[model samples]
Target: MNNPVISVQNVDAHYGERQVLFDVNLDVMPGEIVVIMGGSGSGKSTLLKHLLGLQVPTSGSILVHGKSLHDVSKKELKQLRKKMGVAFQGGALLSSLTVAENVSLPLEYNTDLDQNTIDIMVRLKLELMNLGGFGHLMPAELSGGMLKRAGLARAVIMDPNVLFFDEPSAGLDPVTSVELDELILKLRDAMNITMVIVTHELDSAFKIADRIMVLLDGKVVQVGTVEEIKRSDDERIQNLINRRPRSNQLHGDAYLQRLVNGEGEK
Candidate 1:
């Protein structure tokens, strides 16, 4: 049996005095697409930071390809990160650099390849992302969807084994969002890359994910296939899926007490 490509065990995270994640656990197999979905404040971003080793969990451990994130030496961690690629929300391209330069940045920094080889590699990725002719343009010249493709080109420039995408469909129109989702599936099929996407776009998630993991109040509510998630009996899960607003319940005395005692943070 193949071991999981990514394992997160009993992770707990906090910010100052407030806990953000609770006993979060997940396993991602090689070449799998796992979509992590949650409302804002559900610890999705915090969890992504932990997965990328940008932040250590307060209580548990994370392993990528079997290497403990916290236990690895700095050099080892750097090497491990070479196998990982992250495409942040909003594209995150360097405004100062042209698209080609941005896409070539990874190869330039990580390899001793000559400029000729680097240019060829950059062209390949740009073409893969359908940004071939736009490479000469600055980041500012691109539209939302083009910027996202440019970011994705930069991310996969290294031919990483694992890819992490944050909100791939966040700001795009419906057509563009579907196009990006199709591109995501194409990349996975062609490259055999393991992917972990953080998104709340239900249609996109259902289309692209092999499995969907739902989070609520900083804890996992369910992790299952799309059909299973749709048929879930959990009220919270149903509420989230149906886009039903949470009912506001009165906690008059408790709320008043908390207000007086300054314990209202929840």
Candidate 2:
């Protein structure tokens, strides 16, 4: 690859002494959408935190544009961070700030642009995310989906080269989740920005990902395009893809038969 925009090289993360990610390796090429999928406690979010530089890895390294996050000084790290945008889980918008103000926060801190210029930029981004004229509304005033759109507008305010999203479809209805997936695709197509999305929604993952990386037990179980994954013979991948209940509810007898026969699950 020609210098992937984001690179995770043998990354291992821990919470206190308990390890969360184990030797995780991945990359996001420029303008590509890479989805990380896993069940709860699989460390998908932890890996995202490492990518966002919120937590230092216990071992290995994470690099943005080939510069290791651990090797950068505080000032350099801040500068590097300014080149990226993050849409945290649940939108994470400031309830006190109006949507416009929330979107303008990054601009306010990272640039010396005048108020008028910032206002224009904020409006432009809001419009891009289909939230036009709603910028003056408080986060509490908007719907869940709108809040996510506003949060996305804020994330891209600086036109960062890399964008990170956590659980983009959480708590939304199916229709709303599909809409968000479309918006993700639109942003990538229009801006040519590299995107890394953390999600467990299978439908959303197959719809939006150029490639998907399935994480399990703090390690990558499989990584490939949607078609490849769909045709995979790995038992764990099949179980996830076919929506088969392992420790959960069983779907039907046929599914159980397939599981026993190893048709999809190798």
Q: How does residue 214 of candidate 1 score in lDDT?
A: 97
Q: Among these predicted structures, which one has the highest TM-score?
A: 1
User: Which residue pairs does candidate 1 place in steric collision?
Assistant: none
Per-candidate Cα lDDT values, in order, are: 0.94, 0.90
Tens-place lDDT per residue, model 2, 1-266, is 48798889998888877878888989888888999998888888888888888899998999998888889999999989988999977889999999999999999988999999999999999999999999989999999999999999999999998999999999999999999999999998899889999999999999999999999879999889999989988988888877775465557997888788888531
- In the range 13-113, model 1's lDDT, one tens digit per residue, is 99987899999999999999999998888888899999999998999999999999899999999999999999989999999999999999989999999
Model 1 scores a TM of 0.95
**Candidate 1: residue 225 Cα off by (Å):** 0.6
